[model samples]
Target: MSLRLNCDLGESFGSWKMGLDEAVMPHIDQANIACGFHAGDPLVMQKTLTLAKQNNVTVGAHPGYPDLVGFGRRSIKASAAEIKAMLQYQIAAMDGMAASQGLTLEYVKPHGAMYNDMMANAEVRSAIMQGIAEYHRPLVLMLQSTPQAEEHLAEAEQAGISLWFEIFADRCYDDDGKLLARTKPGAVHSKEKMLAQVKQLQEQGTVTTVSGHTLNLRADTLCVHGDNMDGVNAIQEIRELIS
Candidate 1:
């Protein structure tokens, strides 16, 4: 069995560098590049695309709400129309950069809070689907594995878009297949625990949640946060495990 590994990169803006993009690129199969909404400028985006191309990694657009201060981790209030428009704008911007480099945008993954909100918000989910569909129906939507995620996937599939189910290796989930809230005590696991969790997910198609319950999951791709303090170490361990 094989699984794809993806990482959020190109989040650095201006003088502020974020993520071990250079170090982590070699270990990942796909690179979700920030599209200037949450974090990234034109130069950073271009550089990132080039790096991905050099590394032979698939390029994807990572769009988020206009909340750079919060690193796109804060939920913002917006109507469906606004959400759709913003998404289109972000994707177009990234697509332009990718085009200049002669690299195709392979997928779209909502970043941070925008990603979490869409997991359950029908309006937001539809708006996201509409935005992606406006670009190209074949673009893959990368999403977490959950009941709500399944709903979003079905909607995207109905709209003629492909879906890529993702599982987080650095985050915790509940038995119901929902990601644990960040505010929770055990929301994120340690490096060792994370490795073990990923092993189970990769080998058994299931994860044992903090609540002591198991949930079935389909992990087409695994995600590792680039912003974590131990992000580099986590990536190294995951690569060793998957290899």
Candidate 2:
């Protein structure tokens, strides 16, 4: 069995810095680049795409809400039309950067709060799906696997878009197959625990949630958060364990 590892990169904006993206790149298979909405600018996006090309990493767009201050971690009130337009703009921007680098943008993954919101909000999910459908290009949707995720996946599948199920390496899970709240104690696992989880997901096809319930999961891809200090170390350990 094989699994793809992904990370959110290209998050720095202007003079601000976030993540040790260069250090993490060598260890990850796919790079989900931020598209100037939540945490990136054109310069950062271009630079990141170039690095991905040099490293031979798969590139995908990471679009989020227009909340730069919250880094798209805060939910905003917006209509479906507005949200769809915002997504379209972000996707187009990344597509332009990818084109310049002679690389095709492979997929789309909503970032932070937008990601969690779409899992349960049908309106948000529909808007995102519709935006992708209108693109007229083959693009995969990277998302978590859960009961709430089914509706979005179904919509994407029906629209002929590919779906990649993602599991977090450094995050805890609830019994219901949802990620544990970040604010909760022990919500994020240590590098050793993360490596074990990767092995369990890849070999046994299951993960034991925080509530002590084991659930079957497809480990198509694993994610490492860019901003976490332990992310690089965790990825290295995961690569060694999986190798």
Question: Which candidate wins on TM-score?
Answer: 2
True-structure RMSD, every candidate: 1.6, 1.5
Q: Predicted candidate 2: what Cα RMSD to the true structure?
A: 1.5
Most lDDT-accurate candidate: 1
lDDT of 2 by residue, 1-243 (tens): 688889999999999999998888888899999998899998999999999998999999999999999999999878888888998899989988899889999999999988988886878887778778787687888888775556656688776777888999888899888889889988989777787888888789888899788888766788977566577777888877667
lDDT of 1 by residue, 107-172 (tens): 999999999888878788888888788775457889888756566667987777778889999788
In model 2, the clashing pairs are none
TM-score of every prediction relative to native: 0.94, 0.95
Query: Backbone collision count in every prediction?
Result: 0, 0
Whole-model Cα lDDT of every candidate shown, in order: 0.87, 0.86
